[model samples]
Target: MDIVTANQLKTKGISVIESKLADKKEIIISVRGKEKYVVMAIEQYNYLRECELDAALNETRADYQNNKFITESVEDHIKRITK
Candidate 1:
């Protein structure tokens, strides 16, 4: 991880941030003495989102395998939910 101050960002412009983000990693942006924000490449953010979805799907599969889920037809689900 790398850190940059709000002042530096203001003075140096986004080009500096763009350079740092070239590796597709996160950079910490601090305002005052506190670390407040993160900067990352779009690819990194998308990859993380896909990874989160994959994790959720894996958990759902595990639950189904362990019989920890409910079963119903799509019409039954719609009727139950609509009620």
Candidate 2:
């Protein structure tokens, strides 16, 4: 990962990130010498989001296989979650 200071980002703007991203998948934004944020391309972000959904789907499948799921009405589901 490449680190960019907050000052550099402010002075140089998104171009600084765009240039670094040419060779890197992600860039870290540092504030006061400490890492505070990350910047990445939209494609990479979407890929990660898909990976998260896939993991959730796998977990749900496993739960179903183990008979760990419940059947309930919509109102009951809402009430259970809200509680």
Candidate 3:
């Protein structure tokens, strides 16, 4: 990850960041020595989103296969419904 100060980013302008992003570069924008934001290509962001969805689906499938979902007892259910 490339690091750039917020002031440096302000001085460099969007063209510089866009050019780097177009080449699939990821930039970390720092504010006062702390990383505050990230810039990446749209394709990279979409790829990450898809990967997250796949992981969630895989976890859900695994949980279903293992019968890992929770069940409540009738007494607890009655208390919830009555309340």
Task: Name the candidate that leads on TM-score.
Answer: 2
lDDT of 2 by residue, 1-83 (tens): 99999999999999999999999999999999999999999999999999999999999999999999999999999999999
Q: Please give the TM-score that candidate 1 achieves against the real structure.
A: 0.79
Per-residue CA lDDT of candidate 3, range 1-83, in tens? Answer: 77778888788888767766765558888999999999988788999999999999999999999999767999988998899
Candidate order (TM-score)? 2, 1, 3
Clashing pairs in 3: none
Root-mean-square deviation of candidate 1:
3.0
* Total clashing pairs for each candidate: 0, 0, 0
TM-score for each of the candidates: 0.79, 0.89, 0.74
lDDT at position 74, candidate 3:
93
In candidate 2, residue 42 scores what lDDT? 95
In model 2, which regions exceed 4 Å deviation? none
Name the weakest run of 10 consecutive residues (lDDT summed) in model 2: 39-48
Highest-scoring model, lDDT:
2
**Residue pairs in collision within model 1:** none
* Candidate with the larger lDDT of 2 and 3: 2
lDDT of candidate 1 over 1-83, digit per residue (tens)? 88888998999999879888877499999999799999888889999999999999999999999999868999999998899
User: Which portions of model 1 show Cα errors greater than 4 Å?
Assistant: 71-83
